[model samples]
Target: MTEVAEICSELLRIDTTNDGGGDGPGERRAAEYVAGLLDEVGIEPHVFESAPGRTSVVARVPGDDPDGLLVHGHLDVVPADPAEWRVHPFSGEIADGCVHGRGAVDMKGTLSMTLAWARENARRGARPRRDLVLAFLADEEATGAYGAGHAIERHRDLFEGCSEAISESGGFTWHEGDVRIYPVAVGERGTAWMRLTARGVAGHGSKPAVDNPVAELARAVARLADHRWPVRLTPEVARLIDELSRALGAPIDVDRLEEEIRRVPRAAALFRGVLRNSANPTMLNAGYKVNVIPGSAEAHVDGRFLPGQRDEFLETVDRLLGPKVTREFVSFEEAVSSPAEGLFDDLTAALLAEDPGGRPVPYVMTGGTDAKWFARIGIRGYGFAPLFLPPGLDYFGMFHGVDERVPVEGLEFGVRVLDRLLSSESSTM
Candidate 1:
């Protein structure tokens, strides 16, 4: 097995499961393991704890250029059930030429590639073209309050000269016939985690109440779920579509985008959730007893908006929900968009250098990441955790899915691509 695969397996074995509540085993152990790995390469790493066991690690590799490049990956994984998987979720078993585990694809495998790249550079006594800031963050699966948020709030000086960052959710191989397409993320949709409440009269089971909060809330939830958001294309997605048109030699109608996406099966997964805003009711709460009518009802929604469309999204949502239900934000963050012209050129060059036929395109991520936190400090973040996968692997479906895994060969391929990216000189910095 390659060292990168081994490292990923070991990381998967350490259960850094963040249940979003303060329940799961924290990331302290994983932070320490990463710190030890950096120490082996004669690099000093600083480990910080936001709370008792919520931990993060940061280390810098000084380089010839003054410009800094931040490479970050989270240590947390969403909770997984062992009984639901082909192999135990936390077993980190190497089976069928893949590393099988909960975090093998969500993030741990990508982190392993970065760790391997740093260690390999140390072995050769080489430094990157620009200053490299490596951060292993915590609480990413949750609010990121204890991870990137904490680091920026308390220790912003640690990332002094850094302007650009590369993290998860992009730069993986997507095969279409003989074509290898790499979608590097240039932006992400904004988050609007909301809580809705409906107020009415509390009554006995037999009483015929005029105002039932439970019914009101259920109707609002249904309306929100049934509303079909229209396509609001941002620059990042437009660029992706344009490139896909040229690469696949398929004509795409901007007016009939949904139909066009359906025609190109390979681009459907990448374009599905990102073309417009979306909201789904995830949780609901009402009366304690089935027979009792509740005074108030509450529901939670996972809402996402395309870049530059937050206000419009909220207005439409309010219209759909009606005034019977009131809404308040549980968590709200702006969409992050990076320039597609400069540093992206460097990323594309690096990918093509390793795989000449690989076509690199820019896309907006449907979900948020720790990148949102970094964007607060004026840092541009790109989702680029390079991986080369075989055609049959359902790469996108593996995130927080059953039987999550990463191919062994993909990890090694990522390490080489990372090395090339770090070696290349770019004017963006």
Candidate 2:
């Protein structure tokens, strides 16, 4: 096995599942494993836990420039049910030229690549142009309250002088017909986790009550779930569409953009969610007994809004909820966007160097990342892990999905691209 794959497999076997709100087997073990690797490379690492067992590790490699790069990856994986997988989720088994495990794709694989790159450079007595802050974080699967969020809040010094950061969900190969497209994430939709509550007079189930909270809540949820959010294309997504059109040599019709987007093979699936605001009812609670009507009903919605659309999204949600139901934010993080023209050229050059004819495009992630937290401290985050996978592999599908796995060759590819990116003098065209 390649060094990158071995590191990923070893980390995967540790079982660092983060089940939100400070639950599950914390990432202490995985954090220790990563710190050990960094320590062996003669780099001193600082490890700490925001909560018991919720550990994060941070280390830095000095470069010629003071303001350097920050490359981070979460050590925690989403809880994987062993019963739902063909193999044990945490087994970290290698077969069929793939590393089969929980975090093979969602991020541990990238973490492994980052560690391997740093170790290799250390062994060869080589360093990059700017300082490199390597952070192996915890609690990413659970909203990063105890991981990136914690580190940024409690230990900001670790990331000092780092203006740009790179993390997960990008730099992977996407195949569309005869083309190989690499998407590097430049923006992410905001998180608007909300809770709705409706209160009314409690009454017997048989009685014909005019205002039943459960019925009201059900109606509100139905409206919110069924509401078709209008297409509000952000700049990042617009650039992606335009770039894809140029690369594919296809004329794009702005009025018929949605239809045109769907025509592109892999582009459609990635761009669909970012085209509009979305909210889906995830959890519902109402009556305790079938015969009795509860006075209050509650529901949880997973809502996401495109960048610069929070006000409009909230107003729309309020309108859908009506006067009978009241909604409040469970957790809210604003959408993040960085100028697509910056640092993207370097990423594209690195991918082309590894696999010529590969087209790298800017992507707007439908979901949020710990990048939101880092943005609090004037740091711009880019999703640039750099993985080249086979055309047949559904790279995005493996994220927190059943049978999550990464190709052995893909891990090696990431190591090379990331090493080049880190070693480069400038990440600009």
Candidate 3:
């Protein structure tokens, strides 16, 4: 527990804030720190950069069995503003029984736990039944272009023979009606980041123009923002609804599924975003000068679609954008889903053993992760960081949020759960 908290605090101190694209202070420093820790335990980690300063580290521990397992996490974090936070965003202050920093909960806490567990195993010369591959990735806050995406494209051999992987955002405690439910991610919504452009004749602001591109773009953005997306459940979400209903002892009526889903507090939060594809206007650009109307107005949208909903999502976007507006994908990644039946039992057992009151459930993430990139190589990825958080904490708000922190106890709990899973005989069973 002490070592876990120490490692998490150390990792948080190193500011690896990823500002997207090729910008920001890359992950080289943080990767070097992680590599140093691994090296101290007699394991030589492979540290490489996809682009200049964009570093990622990978290492493996041999086991008795030939099959492989991957444990991965991101080194980069989203940019945080100091002015908006109570403490300096990069301070890494350990106070109030929590490790306070930007990436404490979003990832570095889990990264530290993985590192500590691996280092401990290396020190004791203890190995599991299958090879354990550890990957500390970069550029996850943006797309994984310089992280997992780069690794899969340039260094495919590193993950060869690895059938499954576990990473962030899962195995955490969720309280609902006196039941502590742990929702492990089995699926992620597809990313459909698009840019919308509306074109019209340039004119002075004082002169009234019926065909104003800015006005048209604003209207389109408003429509997309206000549109009530219809509920369309994917298989993963449907399973979640059914399982949650049974777990809560509230049998769902299929004819009135939406009503029942809303009735369950846990189901409402987990299924709302996944029940429908979503598109939100994020950035907008038009004229530079106040007096002149630009001929073209452009806006960026953050879009997410469920599995098998791509065509319908795109068609809806086209209709909302109207005739003058044209759209193109800035970045796109397909939705990923993995079978949770057999694999889930192990995850559930681990959580239940640690805290008998916990009930593990399967849910879909509303956003994307490096898991999407790994899916291309035929490797299934599950979001299973394994933290046992208390009821008072807003776990989801910590991601890219102000004054982000993770409970010291939660970090310790995660270390134990990860150790149990990694040291187990068979993760598949």
List TM-score per model, in order. 0.97, 0.97, 0.94
Q: How many pairs collide in each candidate, listed in order?
A: 0, 0, 0
Pairs in steric clash, model 2: none
When sorted by lDDT, best at the front, the candidate numbers are: 1, 2, 3
Off by over 4 Å in 1: 24-26, 424-429
Single out the weakest 10-residue window by summed lDDT for candidate 1. Answer: 420-429
Off by over 4 Å in 3: 206-210, 252-262, 424-429
Clashing pairs in 1: none
Comparing 1 with 3 on TM-score, the higher-scoring candidate is 1
Winner of 1 and 2 under lDDT = 1
Clashing pairs in 3: none
Query: What does candidate 3's lDDT look like per residue over 1-429, in tens digits?
Result: 388889998888889988875854848989999999999998789999988899999998887766788889999999888999999878888999999998998899999888877777776677776788899998999888999999999988999889888898889988777878789999999999999999999988899886899999999999999998988967898888787777777776656767766677554787777888999999999999999989999999999999889899999999998898999999999999888866567677777778887778899999989999999999898889999888888788788889899998888788777766777442221
Off by over 4 Å in 2: 24-26, 424-429
Estimate the TM-score for candidate 3: 0.94
Model 1, global lDDT: 0.90
lDDT of 2 by residue, 318-371 (tens): 999999999888888999988876577877888888888888989899998899
lDDT of 1 by residue, 1-429 (tens): 889999999999999999989643749999999999999989899999898889999999998787899999899999998889989999899989999999898899999999998887877788788999999999999989989999999989889899999999889999877878999999999999999999999988788978999999999999999998898888888888888877777767888987887788787677777889999999999998878899999999999999999999999999988988999999999999998878888888888878999999898999999999999998899999989999999888899999999999899888888888895432111
